[model samples]
Target: MTSLFPTTLFRPAAAVVAIAAALAPMVSLAAEPFVLQDIRVEGLQRTDPGTVFAALPFRVGETYTDDKAAAALRALFATGLFKDVRIEIDGKVAIVIVEERPVIQSVNFVGLKEFDKDVLIKSLRDAGIGEGLPFDKALVDRAEQEIKRQYLSRSLYGAEVVTTITPTDRNRVNVSFTMTEGDAAKIKEIRIVGTKAFGESTLKDLMDLTAGGWLTWYTKNDRYSRAKLNADLDTIRAYYLNRGYLEFAITSTQVTISPDKQDISITITVQEGQPYTVTAVRLQGEYFGREDQFRSLVTVRPGEAYQASGVAATVKAFTDLFATYGHAFARVEPRTEVDRATGQVALTLVADPQRRVYVRRIDVAGNTRTRDEVVRREFRQLESSWYDGERIKLSRDRVDRLGYFKEVAVETNEVANSPDQVDLVVNVTEKPTGNLQVGMSFSSADRLAFSASVRQDNVFGSGNYLGLELNTSKNARSLVFSTMDPYFTVDGISRSIDLFYRTSRPYNSLGDQYQISNPGGSVRFGVPFTEYDTVFFGIGLEQTNIGATAGIPNQYFDYRFRYGPRSTSLPLTIGWARDQRDSALTPTAGRYQRVNLEWSAGGDVRYLRSNLQYQQFFPIGSKLTLGLNAELGYGKGLGGRPYPVFKNFYGGGLGSVRVFEQGSLGVIDPTGAYIGGASKFNLNSELYFPVPGTGNDKSLRIFAFADMGNVWREGERLDAKSLRASAGFGLSWISPVGPLKLSWGTPLRSQPTDRIQRFQFQIGTAF
Candidate 1:
């Protein structure tokens, strides 16, 4: 030591250095005795003291270090509710200092014209920005951004938002957001480019994409959305493929927006390839029986253009034919061979009949509103037997005809773990099949009128029909009840019965008005003779009570008086019906024809009446459908008797001719009163069109039609020249309530004495 301290300083210097080292160690030992006993916190408004102590790194009796003090400060700041944090140590005590953030007191909205106050508050709360929540700079920024997004979706591109924060008592704060929602943008136009196969107008008619239309109010298809545009493209593709344009393709599509963000436009590009024509067809398959029998069913003819629908029909027919031979497992595959050079095609048919297996079980699903018995009643074939395609197809058609479902489909499911069993699933989607209507109307002659009716196509979920109606209008009073069983017999026979009491007061402007009341009941049965034929018979009794009124035609009163009360008679009815409409409410294609005849044996006026009607629908190319309908009716009183006024025919209006007024087209008296009619005839033709820009017009149709019809007294025979003819346009829209029809009819032929009726229109009618 003496040598190190300049050994020469002195021998005493060495002894002094040794003493200092020993004393310094003793000082450190004494300082270590003063240990940290507890930790204390302040400036805690919302936070608990125990929470702060639990977060401390240095506990009681633990040595204090710089790292421990730094950790405490860091943890306090991590709470996200402090603006400042400080830690201090004094001897054996530790102190934590913090400036707590303000709490949200009451959040409110002002000048919030677009959104509700409660809704906005809830949205803020979801975004971690609401009352009772700690204030944060990052969260407030995120909330502002979210509000902007919500407004943009509503087309409020110019909307604005502003936030305000104010301090309150108890170290709390209040937040409010002010917003102004701007007007929504509207679509300007829609354009299609590079399309040749179909006209621009025609293509637009098939698309849901449009600038604006009635459906836009609900579906908002007018909005410029990518998803809607893509869907439209798919629609276009299906239109072409269904028509045998196999090579059609969509190259590209572009949607442009206006700089002002107030308008939008869409452009679609398409490539139409050469259409294929049929040149030849050959069948290459094993025919178990006579091959000639199967060949006769082919509807496809050589030299005709290839049509996908016709091809599919042929396959279906072939499969059905196989069923008659008990080969229900037969499969028919149709392949198309194309010759690009000649733009021609050849169809190759191949038949493969797998093992014939009996149907072990029939399963039904998706009939949420219909009972299983209703579906089972429509099955023509029994389960636990071999599958027959013919019966299966018929079963599907029967289910579809029930009218309780919107869609009926049969899916063949292969059974697992059972090689010889196949399951047939009949799926049906239920639709509203019951109708309830109540109406009140006011007329110049009648102060008030009311009518109510309840009709159900599916009764008790059994696919039957029942109806009751009552009308209390001043001009008409009626009570009626009816029931029908579409499938009364296992062989598809139908049964029906009707009971009614009706009274009608004729409108007579001159001398007097005639009124009569009749009460009767009838029962009938229908027996199917063929696929498109039926025979029916019935009997009934009735009583008529005529009320005499001034200006009433004496001839009508005389006939009613001739028929005795409680007239017993044997009535006979026969009818034939065949319907093949694509859709009943709005038919696009197919034909329907019916003829009915009725005869009374014992009555004041013995008579026979026959009515015939035929309707046909034909699709012109792919864009238009033409419909033609015609009806003829004739009746003659036997044994020199007078015709019944109630049984007489009345013309005009939607039922007869639209241009003419209701009950105004028949022979009239000098007082401008209508006499009974014994003969009638009607003819109508209409051309249907799709709305300018919309999807298929399944729920609505616009048409232009020509109608000609008239009624004549028994002595007055039906004549074409005497018929009243009208030509005009009309619209049919299927509303939730019922069908609404509006027509503008102008008489094609009119005379000064014939009333010269003006254009007429009507809405909400029963078909």
Candidate 2:
């Protein structure tokens, strides 16, 4: 029972006794009720006078008794504004003496660095310690403790917080908190006690947390995080389970912080149980009478290793299949029976096709700059329609693929009083889709080049792409402007417009450079034939002018003689691309193929050009990937005309055969000048490995590459004997400015007269 009056700090029971003793006189005098009394409150600095009168048990003309006094005391105490209360009566008049708690006049923070000041102030305000509120020492202490806890969560174990309060005029107090945030405890060691199937080094590679690394400051891979450790443990479990160890378990984990609170150590114990192989697999589920189609989705087979990943995939397939039938609540359960003696397991998958549900509403949020319709158009699921898991997942993926958001999430919330309805929330975190760049790059052939670009991917939040680029190099100077509107048509057809002016002095085999000036523009539309496929068709007009220079290639003069100093053409292009890569910038596992065809019919030199390319990336291990790319290009004259000398393909630079100088490959003219070929092919294969000191950072990597290719002149057949090849290694960094690549190639199959350029670099190519 709380006292109606303030109790002693040292002994609350004794204080209660004293309070009663002091009230005994009033109790005896109040045996008989008296009327016609006036009540007056003594202590009133900030509280309203009317409030005290309303809380008094006795009115001005009502009876004043002992019960009234006690009730009044309880009322005042319940208000939490007063600490002391006393009542006295003289001549049928009651006088009330009260002591009010000090109000908080101001609050301040000092020496806090780990958190923003506004955030800390709001946190403390939530804890009932801030300006304009009543001050309590206990609450202040708790706020200080909370501050320390927040720091500890961020690995600042040595942090400290101290709070101080000073009384002010009119019974007010000022509060201040001082915090000292120390160094974050970094992980000094991590040990895996038992490992048999895989080496410790390989297992460690699967975890993102490292004891120490060169990029620890940026990656924070050395700091101890409980959530990261849990994720790491999950990866370890998945690794063993996917490799056939069904009974694998993490036995124990210990995290020890050093006495100085600046270093941390972690140790983990694991049990690698006997590997299990599948003896048989059977499925018993409600597939809506489509068992044959569903059965084929199962990848697990008899006599194969018991693979958890395959089982999970089969389960998802079954679930997705049910979802296609509007079974929104469907679930597939897997049951395994293991035989220890035979080291085998029999698996059975059971399904429960629950009731269907419809989407009540689809709300989009967190797009501060982008319009809601910009996000809604990508969703395949519609409101008021039956919920489909496959469509919902695709909707989320489509939004992510836009590359406008840094993070995208979809959440399903059950509507109240509507068991069959759910609301979907597509939350996105917007990122800066605009960029302004000015930088320089150097290479052995290009020397030093300067470039700049202004691009916006989500212009005015309308989901349009606009870019202007300028590059000034020793052999080339160009300016280009481009724009693309992805929603040009409601059905998701994209339209692209481009205009460019370029002046190029291309290098030839004879070390001669001739200037070619061309200005062109094109308009293209991409029609999506399927989810992953697109067909683009475009028309363009270009005018090319050649400038004769001293020691220029003879082919340039010959083209000027046949087609005049300047010529114009109307070019038509048709292209097809199917991209299944997971990322546009850095793909881990996928295949991309494209074929582009171009022709110019109305020109002095009519020609046709075709290029076909295929690229594939295969994940070889947890930290290794294998990427292969091949391109074949050919050009031919049309209408019985000779192939245009200026319309030639050059191979042997950073983007092509790497061991030779830029544009220094192909048949040589009588003057020893390099004349580019009409046919070109390249085969590039790379084995990408994670950098050793960067932990699991995929942004930086080292790769070994083998490049083989050759260029054939017009009407010349491709021969293996004439192909050139090189094999070497390179490093790639996705730096803040841009992607940078450096390579050192060793010629393997090259002519003795070939211009050898062992080192090469490019500013923006990933491989």
Candidate 3:
């Protein structure tokens, strides 16, 4: 028994040099092999002794040589638990002496307002520095730089980070990062150089990044971000390319910050080559024997100027068509042949159908609260079916329309070692589908209105809807409870049930004592005919009670006398609706149409009522949209009886021809009450634009509108002269509580007897 290896310290700071020095002693002990009787570890504080024992290459009673000792040392250092390691051998015992790195007691941040503390903590933890872990000086330094880099991304060029390490008892340390974040640097100037075909201002207008503007504070477009600048450059390049500048190129871009780092200047240099015309568009490679049909999808015309957008569209269409035929990996590349002398380009769409594949499986992820079945039931792309791009896209849209998720995405991944099979992944980010709202609104007609609703669109993650709503206003009060099962029959058919009680008092009514009370319940079923169309049918039983008071309208009194104070009606309703809008909350494009018919053939009331509505929106530009809406209503007696006065249609208000009081455009009773009519027609046109300080946010917009409509009695002739017209401007906002609309209308054509209300507003209503 004798000392074989001398104790030598190894530090990671200079691992190469320290390991070389420590190994020098081990070489002398290599020739002498010893049988270890015991192994002991020193400098144990927070780390368990078993951790060191597990990493050792040799155990007690095993023969230990220089190679095993060196292996053990390397393994121990790799654990990152110790900052210094030394092995001492005395006779038949091996002593592993180590200096453990300080465990992080706490990691704190000071003056951290730009980012959440937890976010920064997680970032630091990912970088190997956090509470409950060994502290590394190099990692701490790197983390400081990373923090500064994050601030720089937010345009805070003057941001500075200082890391402080404080040692505490029990081999623990506290780490604190103090940040001094100054003002953000803004783009003071942006210039596009080498632009001759178009004005510099015009080209700059196409870029999202811009100099300081009134809206820059909110939009942050003036912030100097490298990613944003790159995106803007792409937008500029696309603009030129779409305008026939086939050889347009961004030669160079220069971004410079001021000495104080408070202002930044950007200059983009472009090479706008000569514009080219399309000589011909030829299809090459393979068309799967559908050459003629593929040719019809080509959007690049031979006689038209060369447009990159057209070429891109043609390529996408070709690939999409191929995908519909089970070619999941179709590739369509546009090969351009340019004739410089003639300034003409010949575009050839090269298609490669590759290998046809079918879906092997459909996987869903990212739904924590909602059940997986809720999302899977919406998919039309079935497993083990031929891959259809159109069906996959439809499935994504269908899941998105459910409103249970914030984001719904479908991705196709090729299966490993299976070229003929692919897997479809549906990723959904679930959002809160339950809403409890209590709100108040005001309007010229309804001075004060209160509303409360408890709704769950995805009740218990079952994809069912349950809601209870209560609304009270000066002219109307209603309480309704409803529920809907979207997959009632598992064939995309829906079923809905509603129970409601309503009380209504006409505008200009003398008192609340005279009113109409109606209570009803209905069960409706929706049958889907197409992707965007649905037909609904339902039956309802209602009882109407007309109250009598002084100064009551003659029409209502006469009706109650003939039909009795209480009248019961059994009504059958059928409706058809088609929604093709890009968004239900903020529609910028597409059309929506609806038609409803209600017929009461039994009980004390017998009549037929029909209503039709059409709406269309046209996106004029990036920030502007035009919308048009038309509605018509008609009612008639079916059994030689007069149409129910209590079932009349009303017009004029924020929803109809504004500037006229609510429900004041119909026939007026001799008692001065506004009695609505059985026939109504309304038309509306609106131009919507982004608010001045809101940038491209569609949630806030300003619109100019023109409304024209009137209500007439069932037997009365629909007179053009009687129609009321108004023009006005309004503000629309999708607020946290609900959709809010404020309008100020001036009557362009109004009768002297008509009640006028120039201003009106409401919440939770949409056009």
Best by TM-score: 3
Which regions of candidate 3 fall more than 4 Å away from where they truly are? 1-110, 116-143, 164-177, 367-372, 415-418, 438-452, 470-478, 502-518, 543-567, 601-605, 637-641, 670-672, 691-695
* Backbone collisions counted per model: 7, 2, 0
Task: Please give the TM-score that candidate 3 achieves against the real structure.
Answer: 0.85
lDDT per residue (tens digit) for residues 14-96 in model 2:
34435644664564355567894587789888888887878877888887777777777766655656666778777778888
The C-alpha lDDT values of all candidates are: 0.72, 0.84, 0.86
Model 2 alpha-carbon miss at residue 241, Å:
2.8
TM-score for all models, in order of appearance: 0.69, 0.78, 0.85
For this target, which candidate reaches the highest lDDT against the unseen true structure? Answer: 3
**Model 1 segments more than 4 A misplaced:** 1-193, 196-206, 213-231, 238-246, 255-262, 273-352, 366-371, 429-435, 440-449, 487-490, 560-570, 603-605, 764-767
Could you tell me which residue pairs clash in candidate 2? 509-674, 510-674
- For model 2, the superposed segments whose C-alpha errors exceed 4 Å read 1-186, 194-202, 213-220, 339-342, 358-363, 382-386, 413-423, 507-513, 667-675
